[model samples]
Target: MEIELVNCECCGLKEDCTQDYISEVKAKFDGKWLCGLCSEAVSDEVKRGKKSSFGMDEAVKAHMSFCGKFKSNPAVKVADGMRQMLRRRSGDLSSSSSKKFMRSAST
Candidate 1:
């Protein structure tokens, strides 16, 4: 199967995160998946006085659900190098975009 190099659903980084990390985080949070960078950014923004937000958890959950569909598939064990490749091409996922992604993902 072809793996999509989407932005990490945790941190808003446009990196191509592995399906494993994405799935793990997604399942842990009710299907809301944040890109790795976005996830950290949200936490950091919160620390920087940004107001609290919602729907992130849902995005993570979606990511998890998406991954779950692939569980037991060989793609789940994709190499770390592939993730690095995605990261290299990833863009800066803004908090706003993160929210949008989450909202769209949930719907």
Candidate 2:
């Protein structure tokens, strides 16, 4: 039941988590702790690499490299964050409009 601060091995993002949760994450990622986003990215990489013989270690390394590039460039990270936010907002607007259009067409 102890809470500890864990730093993600990939992105270096620190998270406050219970000791049990930290142990679980480390166990899953080959004894390295990863934040939620990095873990998901690594999982996606593994799924995408299934046909190319990529293993968990390789996927983690690849994701670490990718995150390292952004970590060195603060401006790039900000720009990327803004871009993602806009893309998500736009997607929400589009989906709502599409639903309205479908309703109108049905009528």
- Best by the TM-score measure: 2
**Residue 85 lDDT in candidate 1:** 67
**Cα lDDT computed for each candidate against the true fold:** 0.53, 0.86
Q: Roughly what TM-score does model 1 have, to 2 decimal places?
A: 0.30
TM-score for all models, in order of appearance: 0.30, 0.68
Q: Which candidate gets the maximum lDDT versus the true structure? A: 2
Candidate 2's TM-score reads 0.68
Candidate 2 Cα errors over 4 Å, as ranges: 72-107
Model 2 C-alpha lDDT per residue in residues 75-94, reported as the tens digit of each score: 34656899999999999999
RMSD of each: 18.8, 6.2
